[model samples]
Target: MHVPDGFINAPVSVAAGAVAAGAVAVSLRGARRELGGTSHAEGGGERTAPLAGLVAAFIFAVQMLNFPVAAGTSGHLLGGALAAILVGPYTGVLCVSVVLLMQGILFADGGLTALGVNITVMGVVTVVVAYGLFRGLVKVLPRKRRSVTVASFAAALISVPAAACVFTAIYAIGGTTDVPVSKVLTAMVGVHVLIGIGEAVITMLTVGAVVAVRPDLVYGARGLTAPLKLRVGGELVDAEPAPVPVAARSPRAVWATGLVTALVLAGFVSFYASASPDGLEKVAADKGIDKNVEEHAAKDSPLADYGVKDISDARISGGLAGVIGVGVMVVAGTGIFWSLRRRGTTDATPTRVPESV
Candidate 1:
């Protein structure tokens, strides 16, 4: 649901911009902890930074592959649920926000002026709702691999409609047109529910796959397995820690694999994505919610609309654009995460212990 320019009045858009800015500020601080703070000897920050970047790139690639939801409506991965499960909530928000930013300025998929709305709805709302519910479910459900996947599915499924409702509420307050709020709400929620199913399945499979290979890398699965307890005297004490697996200590393999997957998805598989309008696009057209929609400022960019400007072949043009997008996203995401991780590491540095007297 990338809100284009003119969908919201200036006042409300500015208000939403403030909210989005605040959310991003908070997420930046929170992401530092998620990236750097870990009890592992291998340094959680070092291992997690690259993975988080890959997650962002993967989300960008996946969003290009829109699956058909209704007769003429399609939906794509929001990435909040997947990112939160893979990384953390704060990082998840940043990931989606980065995607939205790139899409706006480069691809012209989302509007530059509406960046705030898109970030608030697609980035903030989806991550908060998905991660909060995911944590709750993880707490109640059995601590197992399956439980994480199941929780991911549920969280992703709910997050879509939750975002849709939030968008409807925002539009109700400052819609540029005279669309009925009730009708918009009903239609948005109804269609997004189906879209959520697609989100859930994708989340479930992706989380399950990652968990199967490296559960330790998955933030949601981090503490799922409790430490072994040993009875000593009348009390139970934690057993000695197990050695870190050789494979788990390094993220290079996983990073390479993930990057390759993202490249393939965006560079090739996206060509098969449905041509139908997405849920929000369809709703806007049908309900006249886009009556005042303005043209994208970057409409003339070489990569606008996910196609190369002078490339005659649709396949080559789209694929080149997609590849470029993935590359840029990976570099941008990794740089941001690495900076956060460095700051976290500095903050978490220990004071020098006094040498033995």
Candidate 2:
């Protein structure tokens, strides 16, 4: 959920900002290793570096579609589980953080003042919880593609309520006004539990689709099974590794397809998404959660409220804004990931060992 301005006090917000900053810093370092230490210049960076950018753009686009969850309440993709399964946890954190940054600066979907809170709750917390549980589940379940899908579902289902609880705790600590904390907690977690179901379904479907098409590209599926071995009368025989077929589409082609899908979702499909207030917004209104809510600083921006300022047609305005958002997200995310991937390669390269006397 995108926390609006005044949702959290300045002191707590600042503290959360520091936490978010540290998390991003650590994730940046971690993403390098997760990208397989491949620089684009070396022609070895296709695995997760570019795909990480696509993941970020895809999450941003999917989040625009708010599926109805209850009476007048809708839910969108948190995407921590989806990203973590598709990419690695560190890269997943970066993906969601980048989306939050774009939404805050370009779209004004989230409050700039509460940027740290949003990143902390939505990016760090959700990614950590989902990825942790996912790894745990994968260890216990059968080492199959289906197991990865199941783990992704369970991880996503839990992450939503976990985030809601975290927000409630934050509000409890730094709330701007007096309200029944218990009531807020109940409402927040209850509705989000239902929202979690939606999150799980989306995460499972997306992860499964990718696993089915290209299991090698899935980070969570790596190392799940060992090489084939046969047992004959108390003797173990190693079988030859099966020759894998080349993918029908090159990595660049797959990246292009994913980018196109993200654009289509944001630029067109979002037009028909439910217009109802999302879960957090609905809860805030019903429970007086925004008693001290302040106007966003960027309220008058051209793309504020997910629409262009002077565009008369609602569809055109929203479509243009969505397209602009997707484009910006792709360029920005790709730049960040590629730079990190290159830096990682340089750092990981071993220095020449001089001859010792």
Among these predicted structures, which one has the highest TM-score?
Answer: 1
Worst 10 residues of 1 by lDDT: 37-46
Q: Which stretches of candidate 2 lie over 4 Å from their true place?
A: 38-45, 229-244, 247-249
lDDT (10s digit) by residue, model 1, range 1-357: 888999999998999999999999999999999998656633366778888889989999999999999899999988889998899999999998999999999999988878899999998999999999999999999988999999999999999999999999999998999988999999999999999999999999999988887887888888787788999998999988676588665578888989999999999999999999999999999999998999999999999999999999999999989999999999999999999999998988988988997
Candidate 2, residues 1-357, lDDT tens digits: the string is 899999889999999999999999999988888875454223244578888889999999899999999989999999888888888999999999999988988788888989999999999999999999999999999999999999999999999999999999999999887878998899999999999999999899888988887676788888677768899888998776554457634667668888898889888999999999988899899999798899888888889888989989988888788888888888899899988888887888989999999
Candidate 1 Cα misplacement greater than 4 A, ranges: 41-43, 231-236, 243-249, 351-357
Candidate 1: give the clashing pairs. none
TM-scores, all candidates, are 0.95, 0.93
RMSD of 2: 3.0
